[model samples]
Target: MKAVVIGGGIAGLLAARVLTESFDDVVVLERDKLSDEPEYRAGVPQGRHVHGLLVRGGEIMEGLFPGLRDELVRSGAHLMDAGEMRILNPLGWVASGRSGMPLLVVSRPLLETHIRRRVTAKIVDDAHVTGLTFRGSTVDGVLTRDGRIDADLVVDASGRSSKLPAWLAEAGIAVPEPEVVDSRTGYATRLYTAPPEIPVVVAESLSAPDTPRGGIVMRIEGDRVMVTAQGAGGDHPPRDPEGFQQFLDSLRGPIAGMLADAEPVTPVYLFARTASRRIAFEQVTGWPGGLVAIGDAVCVFNPVYGQGMTVAAMAALLFRRHSDFSAKGCRDFQRKVAKTAQGSWVLSSNADQSWAGVEKTPAPLMRAFRWYMKKWQVALVHDQDIFLRFLRVVHLVASPATLMNPVVFRRLAKYSRLDPRPGRRRAARSPR
Candidate 1:
């Protein structure tokens, strides 16, 4: 069997890698010209920004491509314990300790390059997939500028810009309107040579409702660090160097002072498309056979939560586990994919609701959840166990329900008296 995967990005490459195990031939179609070396491409506009491989994501990728973590470290990527990273939440700084979760800090291009190199499938660059080719009710292939490429199966990993919905509509399939929640988040990022004086490996001050500004500084490959200044609820970081630095200085953390004298290696790059959107393909009537969508094609999360890549990895793993390719089987797989994304969608969309100007008001349950989460953040400040549980949930290693355990409820009740004011902590003095 032949499988055609559209978009040679991380999702597409990963899907192709998984397809190689079952399909006799697998081909990936990417619009941009991919190079052997790690470099930014136009297709991934946010490639220059700071990216994190969650502990669960790293574990999944390592399983798909063994020794991937070691290879990255060998190429200068930093492998550090996740708990060591300094994080300023809405309340205060989370206590630091070893959480047993390993974080692999690497550039997007580097990670993509390594994954692409490991994939045994054929990857065709500069190939633009316009639409799908249907054999009656089943999607048999994809249409490209060159010609029709037939396949027994077609996987859509075209990301947020995917045209699968339109293609299905044209084929008389009724697709449901995608659920969307936007916080109007924007990012301005720049790369800098790692200065000897900078002692932090990864530091972040997350944006909150009261304080819309946030910043992150993390070490990546090439002995360099990436600094991203971000804002939410329409407070966007400026693209100009002076303005960018000023924005950094406005953050609640010490990232600005840490990078005060660092030499910049790249110009400021701005990315503003951080909305959370989910296409409910499983809800569509008459879903086509021999077709599946993964990654951003199905759901796109706010990059601020650092959930997109991890969710994509989880979806690809779901695809790998699915064995049936019949019409009903395809529908079942799509439903499974949707189920897998539900947790992340909840985490990110609910968080975005905290920003001002969001149209969607939280339900009573969500409101209570948010209230509890605020107390949980306060608890995280001095409780290493709570911090580790939060880390595990965010990393996709544990269920969100774990945070609602009786132990956590008791902890929150204890910390309830210490209702730390939001965004009131003094600027972080130094990285832990």
Candidate 2:
């Protein structure tokens, strides 16, 4: 069987890698010129921002590619435990001990390039995909500007700017409306030389209700730390250095102190589109078979949550599990992938909605969950076991349902009464 994967980013590479196991031939179509080295491009605008392979994301990639993490480490990416990182969350400072999630701190382009090298699919960069070729209702292949490439299976791993809706509509198929939950958050990132004594990653969650902002400083390869300062509702992070410092100073913790006198390596890069979008592809009437959409093409979460790459890996896992290529099979895969994304969707949606000016109404269940989680975050500060479990959920290593256990709830209730605010340790503790 032949398979064609559109948008040769991480999602497409991983999908092609998996498809190579079953298909006789696989073609990866990319719009940008894929580079051998880690660098910039027009296709992945958000790739310039800081990215981390959340525990499960790294594990999923490792399972699929085998030794990819080691390659990243050898090539300069850092594979450290999340415990070594310092996090200042909304409730308070979380005490770090065991790094439960196998975290990989690396730039997006480097990761993409490494994965691209491993996948056996023939990648056609600079190939602009126009639409799909349909045989009755099944997608027989993809139609690019140059010519048509026939395939038995078509996987749309294109990022958020996917042409799926337009193609589906052009083919006389019903296009699914995207469900958008946006906080209108924006952030600016600048690269600086790694500080003398900085943790591999520092996630300072300015989760306070009045001034909800976020900041992250991650040590990537090439002895540099990428810092991202974010704000919501048009409250964007500044692009200038002096103003960027001001944004850093306003955080719950003063990362400015750590960045004190650090040499700037790159100018600030701004990314403002922080909306959570999901397409109900499964619910689309007369949905065609032999085609499936993955990655940001199907669902786009707030980048602050860092679930984008992880969820993409999870989608690859989903494809591997239900290895069916027929129309009914592909349609079933699309719906199942959405079902898998529900937990991750809720995790980020709850966080982004915590800020003001976010107009989306929370579901009754999410409303109740947020109410309980407010205390849970506070409890997380004082309790290590709860913190670990919560981290597991955030990392996609465990189910969100685990947090609802009666025993866990009882503990949270006890902590809730004792410490209403939850994060007991607000002061920054230098990494051990």
Among all candidates shown, the one with the greatest lDDT: 1
User: Candidate 1 regions off by >4 Å?
Assistant: 423-425
State each candidate's clash count: 0, 2
lDDT by residue (131-204, candidate 1, tens digit) is: 99888878899999999999999999999899999988888898999888999999999999998766445455
lDDT of each: 0.86, 0.83
Provide C-alpha RMSD values for all models, in order. Answer: 1.3, 2.0
Please give, for residues 184-259, the per-residue lDDT of candidate 2 as tens digits: 7888999898876877887876553554676888888898888899887667888998998888887767577878
TM for every model, in the order presented, reads: 0.97, 0.95
421 Cα displacement, candidate 1 (Å): 1.6
